[model samples]
Target: MNKRPSILIVDDEVSNIEILSAVLEEDHDIYFATSGDEAIATARAALPDLILLDVLMPGTDGYEVCTSLKGDPLLADVPVIFTTALGDQEAEVKGLELGAIDYIAKPISPVVVRARVRNHLEMKRMRDDLAKLAVTDALTGLGNRRRLEQALNIETARLALTSGTLSVIILDIDFFKRFNDLYGHTAGDRCLTMVAAALNRAVHHASDLTIRYGGEEFACVLPETEHDRAMDIAHGIRERVEALNIPHSGSDVAATVSVSIGVATAACVPGATPEAWVKAADAELYKAKAAGRNSVSGRTFQVVVEDARPLSSTA
Candidate 1:
């Protein structure tokens, strides 16, 4: 079942909190914070869909809270609505400047509050859906290259901070053009879809992203994975795709459809970039293609230095 939208109601007065909760409780999972400090902490923890902030407070007023929330990357997109008794145009402009989507004046009208909350939440839902579609591949329903890059950037940044490991595997359909030439585009598409599913099944973790990187090329981003584990996964992808037994009468590789895979694992260091990480994997893919198709090649970087340059590499 889908979860209810969550709202954080912030007010120093218990009475105001009660009144707001009474109005919104039926439709939303409500969380409360009594002061600005508590509000920021709760917002980080709860990640509420919308925040109803009371402007006047003892310390860390609503404007300050909104500024803090908007500054945070994770919480920035959350909608914040200021509930202020202050009726001046200047005050309203101040709240809007701090990134609050709408302002609800006190003594809060239940009807107006509900309508505004519903509208903003609906708009947020539409935006979230469109963002998902933008990074998704239309053909095989796998994440597209844009999604791959975004995931890689996120993982690389996180690992760089923690000095952890990251891995990437790039896979190419062996003799794919020949397969299309022999089988026609429809069968070729079917083969690609089957291969995508095989890759999906090969990756076990929720954090592992399998992407259709581009025509006949796919990639996987495995965060915090080691070289041996990544190599095992690369080999697993290769075995699974070949097991599908899609005939490839095109010369060489194998009778059934197969893929060439290359993997690169790195112990992340500061200043690492996603582009450098992908290039390392792509270099290995070239080696796999050079040696022969239908094989897996892997390597490891001892440490990624400034600008994602590897300090050392090992086969």
Candidate 2:
């Protein structure tokens, strides 16, 4: 079952909060705050889909609360609705300027409140769906290049603070172009999908990301993983793809489809760059291709606090 959308109601008067909750509780999960400071704290904690805020409060009025919500990166996108007794146009304009999506006058009509909340929630859901689709691969149902970059940026930034380990694996289907020419594009697409599924199965952690990195190539971003563990996963992927037994008549490596993998691991530091990490992996990929198309090549980098240097080790 789908989870119900949540709402946070902020009003100084206990009666006002109870009224809004009575109206919204059946269709949505409801939370309440009695002051503007409490409203901001509750919004951050609950991450509500929509916030119904009262304009008049003892401290930190609704306008100030809305400003703080808009300023927070994690809470910025949450929709805010001002529920205030101030019926004047100037007051409404001020709330809108501070990023409230809608202004509802006091002696609120339940029907209008319901309609506005439903409309805004639907709009938020659509925006979220579009955002996900933008980073998804159409054919493979895996994350695309854009998603990979986003994950890398986030994980690496976390690493800077935590001094944790990060790993990346790049895999390429052996003789993919020849396979396409021999079996046709449709068969090639089927092959790609199958490989993507295998990769999804291989990654065990929720934080790990498997990406379709353009044609014939794929990538994995593993956070808080060590060199030996990353190499093991890479080898597992190579074995899994070969085990699929998707026939590749044009291949030199094996009768069945196979992959060459490159792995890179590093102890992350403040000055580290994701591009350098990927480049190291790509260099290993070149080596894997040169040695033979159905193998894994890997290296680990030890990062200094002040500088990053590659401490290459072949696997």
Candidate 3:
């Protein structure tokens, strides 16, 4: 969608407001607020893409306004820039510390103002795009396995330093081979996408990842979590899959989309290794399959044994 950048200009001086508006008008849809109260009201109603506030405004200066805007979760991500006559080092530092993305000095150069505004907006655009790419699976539009591994590593590192806990889950759709056989490969592709949507919808954490680990299997990684919690997450995954009501002709019930999951956690894996963690998780996964076809099994184990010992204190 082609949309103009929306900017809210807050200043006590009408002349400064007019000057800034003239400078930014071509590149943005400019809105002016002579007082902090009006600025806040306009910001709430329109939710401008960016905000430019004057530091020396009367009754709730830019600093207080910036602080208030940041306190709101909905407004928190909107980048703010301070347009202040106080162009010294101290003012710049204060504005930055208050979470302003950029600082603009007074006697504004149209070129400098335009360049900086465009720069911050472009940077934000790139950042949001990069963040989405990092977490997304290219084929399935689901979270990728790399996302899962990263979440696990962060939790494990935190636990290694502070003795916390972490958990993971490995889920595989049972008899998925028969699904491919009866429905043909193209239908199998649709089945995967449907199941991935269910997994994505079922997961609740921003940090949590739902991965299409490979053909017919998926994984979920949980941080600051334990085996029991992992099991609960797995059950939710299974239930969500079934709730899709996707037909499985080869299975019983005439309508069955199920997964067998293995889950594991570690509070104090005395010695941790990626291999050890995967083995533990896989072992529990096997246990789930052995016990039944549509259930979750939980396991917890201590970390021990690594080839590199004394030198790897980080372990």
CA lDDT, every model vs. true structure: 0.89, 0.88, 0.77
The residue ranges of model 3 lying beyond 4 angstroms of the native Cα positions read 1-135, 252-255, 268-271, 305-315
Task: List, residue by residue over 60-172, the lDDT tens digit for candidate 2.
Answer: 99889999999764578899999988788999999999999998888989999999999999999999899789889999999988887767766775576678999999999
Model 2 weakest lDDT span, ten residues long: 306-315
The digit string of per-residue lDDT tens for model 1 on 42-92 reads: 987798999999999998998999999997645788999999888989999
Q: lDDT value for candidate 3?
A: 0.77
- Model 1 Cα shift for residue 123 (angstroms): 0.9
lDDT of 1: 0.89
C-alpha lDDT (0 to 100) for residue 55 of candidate 2: 90
Model 2 regions lying over 4 Å from their true place? 8-19, 30-47, 53-75, 150-168, 204-208, 221-233, 263-293, 296-315
Q: After the best TM-score superposition of candidate 3, give how far the Cα of residue 57 lies from its true spot, in angstroms.
A: 32
Model 1 residue 278 CA deviation (Å) reads 1.5
